[model samples]
Target: MLLVVAGAGAAGSVTFAAQAEPADPLAVYAARIVGDRARTRIVLEFDRKPEIAVRYIARPDRIVVDLPSTVFTFPEADLEARGLFRDIRYGSMDADSARLVLTADRPARLVASEVMANESGTGYRLVLDAEMVSQQDFEKLVNDQSWMTASVDATATAQRGDRVGQSEPAAPGAFVIAIDAGHGGIDAGATGAATKTQEKEITLAFAKALFDRLKGEPGIEAFLVREGDEFLSLSERVTIARQRGANLLISFHADTLRQSNIRGATVYTISDKASDRMAADLAERENLSDAVGGVSDTGEPAEVSDILLDLTRRETQAFSISMADSVVRSFEGQVALINNPHRYAGFRVLQAHDVPSILLELGFLSNKEDEKLLLDPAWRVKIADLLAAAIRRYRLPVVANGG
Candidate 1:
């Protein structure tokens, strides 16, 4: 990457010249973090009718953002004081959209999201809401036992001792993980035009790998929506996560787009408008995965009761972002970043009854460099190992709590 000036008269800064020919007007992906009633929040931004998407995912804590080829103009001093973000990054993830990943000191929230054309209408503006959480309350939420109730039941069933060992017929431990491998039997997600690797297979393999690593944790366990190759409706997937009383959910997948050179790993949380063009496009594709297999979003989620549940929603959202930070921190050096690495999109699998969730696109089948990593068992295992370690570290405090 080289640096150059920006204007004829305006003092040119050290901005790099266009790295490559601009493909189609790429998406302008943007997001922010906020504090909820009790949780951390994340808000995303983008311009015009850019494709965008969002979702809430569990496990390894994080939010993912994807955008078309676009340049970020934030300055060093401004970023340093951005309290909502624990840390931030940007780089050429692929030909399209530079990815962004923001790590948080604690769980936060995503709120006050809106997208519209500027009054002048020459271009667009994306706004985000990032809130801060007090340390004491953040700790309280982390160690809370209400969510840990499942562990107590599992231990009682074992009776003999802890649920770690001894086949108690009672399955596994306290926390349940909802693993979603995007696409299914008949649904071949994005395909690599050069390598012909289907996204369905790549995602399923990654999900299973992550699941396998979570098996031995003390208060944690996991479950998959589809153990084998079969098309399960999106609602059914949600049902399965709730059925197991999961505390977290993680969805896995790889997608291909017309932007062949775009690629990198992305973590996604949930949002209605989506952050940018790429995020919106990806969310659309993922939400439509079931359609390829003859299923549809029934638009029926269980009724929300117990206003207490509302109290925890914000807390849960914060926890999700905190978790995402851990994963992003671990990804440093191990992999490259897309301009706005972490993004938001409307992902269905993340819509659980109460489970905190995260969806990770390990890489893109669309980019040649990324495609190579996605197909590499070594790379896959490395990422999975990092994820498992991060989750383990992320949960230690919770485990310490009386819960």
Candidate 2:
């Protein structure tokens, strides 16, 4: 087994023992992680030089290395999470390809990544150096997707806006609504107190019910931001809405709070300053979804100063507020709502400059009563129906005016 320990100063050493050649064309026998929080280095010793492709992905900054089929025989602890990296994984992607994914703690870039032969020429070494960078620089790296990788997965392609079921253009005059189901995959949002059901499952079920309820309506097109139990960054959620040309974006979440007694639906719109302490605290927690899912929090979206864009945002915010009010009104007797249900906060998922967006807290999972209701299929159907009614009411005026 290869054992690695950091030495004094900025260097580290990996002790390896020679082993018999493996039948596989390529094999990685050793790997190590070196450096600190500001920078990180990863070295992998291979039996021979292997063709590699590197790509940078954003919406939670990650570096991906695509390689030919190979056997990874190193100990799992050799490349444990440390420094700038929050998590690391290497495994077979398919029968012919292998992948190494590195998720950063913050916006980062691979400053150096290359393969070179060892001094004795018996093997090759794959070295990668990652360093923290400004969000702008990292975004630039993500945008430059000129990697020569042989193929791009469906998810990656869809993330760039060519979704499978949504590639076809919406019928003209259709009022599109993008329903975002918050917290999935590695980030499970909140867990139910009684049933222990995950928030992701709840949101997805509600989102689907709402979508099914709305899809049959005339001149309306509803789609899910994340159709499955997969994680998406706050920005990606907003981007999906924008790319789909959605007139309204509604994000569904069920979160726990310090006050377990507080359990009810709340509609939130974006604001530079939160409407109250509760709003601020909730926004802070929800914004950390990326970090919780091993993706770096790149802070809020950049402030736009253009006069036209500013005006557009003001109009959009007004629409968002109106939608929130409609939601609260629709749930008045049909569903429970927290005090001051129409609140405003600087939620990243609601920061799409032109899209009218709102984050809807279905109900706190911390409260046993609310947890039971959140998990009840009948309750979900009732709530979804009410939400669909609210959407129709909010868009009625626009639809009437031939908008």
Candidate 3:
């Protein structure tokens, strides 16, 4: 075993080892982010040196670090608001690989990264340093850095390619609906106050129910973007719907509010500006799903725009508003809805440019009544049927005329 101590007066004082015995598994005991907006340093304390790979992605900008399966013993509070980064998350990406994703509030570039033994020679420390950069410089860095390496597994690359290429075109006159169950895996979304039910479970249950209901409809073909408890980035969700040629995308969610009295279903369409403060807050929380799920929020930046993309987004926004209205109308008597149920916000999951997307908040889990209703099987089925009716109403005219 090779051992050393971190530099004097560093952010953290910890001993580390460069390597460990083959029989020993590497474990991360503590992790923290230090420094200000201009510069940021990430420090990780481990039982042994870890094999790490780093890469950068653009849009909202982020740095992704891949490591061997690690046993993380850090506290959840460690992931709270940090300097330099808007948010940070770390978790197991797969059976063999773990991932740490950091979201930068502005353009940032990795300055230095290395794993060294602590000076006291007890354990290992992984240090990463980054600094803010101009947009042009960040773009160049993103273009230059490649995630793929010679050590990358060939089978994994092929599998990813196969998944992307396997999308089939939608049939003529068929109304394809992409149901996105909000929050999964590490991102548990909201939790019910009384029932302790997770927002992810609620959304998945509703999405599956709606999918099944749509299957029996004549001209409708529906599928789930995620079928199981798996995490997907907001951008990936949009990409999947677009790749599958989905005409409409409905993201199901059960959000919570600090105000326990605010307890009703609501429909949301994408907009650059939110309709209300509550809507804005909800959108912000929903958009953080990627960060919550150990995925960096490297979304496409708003300033980097194209005329054609703007036009497409405008057209899609119109359709999305219409769909939101349809759902609100359908739920008028069948289900309880929040006042001014139809709202608009900049929801990242609903930004497919072409696919008309709406986020349906089933109810607020913070409310006792809403929590009870959300946990009821009968209520779920009723809500799913109502949503299916709304979709059919929205699609019938377009599909009948071959749109």
Candidate with the greatest TM-score versus the true structure: 3
Candidate 2 yields a Cα-based lDDT of: 0.71
Query: How well does candidate 3 score on lDDT at residue 143?
Result: 70
Task: Please provide, for model 1 over 297-384, each residue's C-alpha lDDT reduced to its tens digit, 9 standing for 90 to 100.
Answer: 3454766777787756655556666666667788778777667767777777665535566667676776777776766666666777
| lDDT (C-alpha, whole model) for all candidates | 0.53, 0.71, 0.69
Best by lDDT: 2
Query: TM-score of model 2 relative to the true fold?
Result: 0.65
Give the alpha carbon lDDT tens digit for every residue of 101-130 in model 2: 788889888888989998889999999999
Clashing residue pairs found in predicted model 2: none
Deviation in Å, model 2, residue 121 alpha carbon:
28
Q: Candidate 1 — which residues are off by over 4 angstroms?
A: 1-173, 216-219, 300-302, 401-403
Ranking under TM-score, best-scoring first?
3, 2, 1
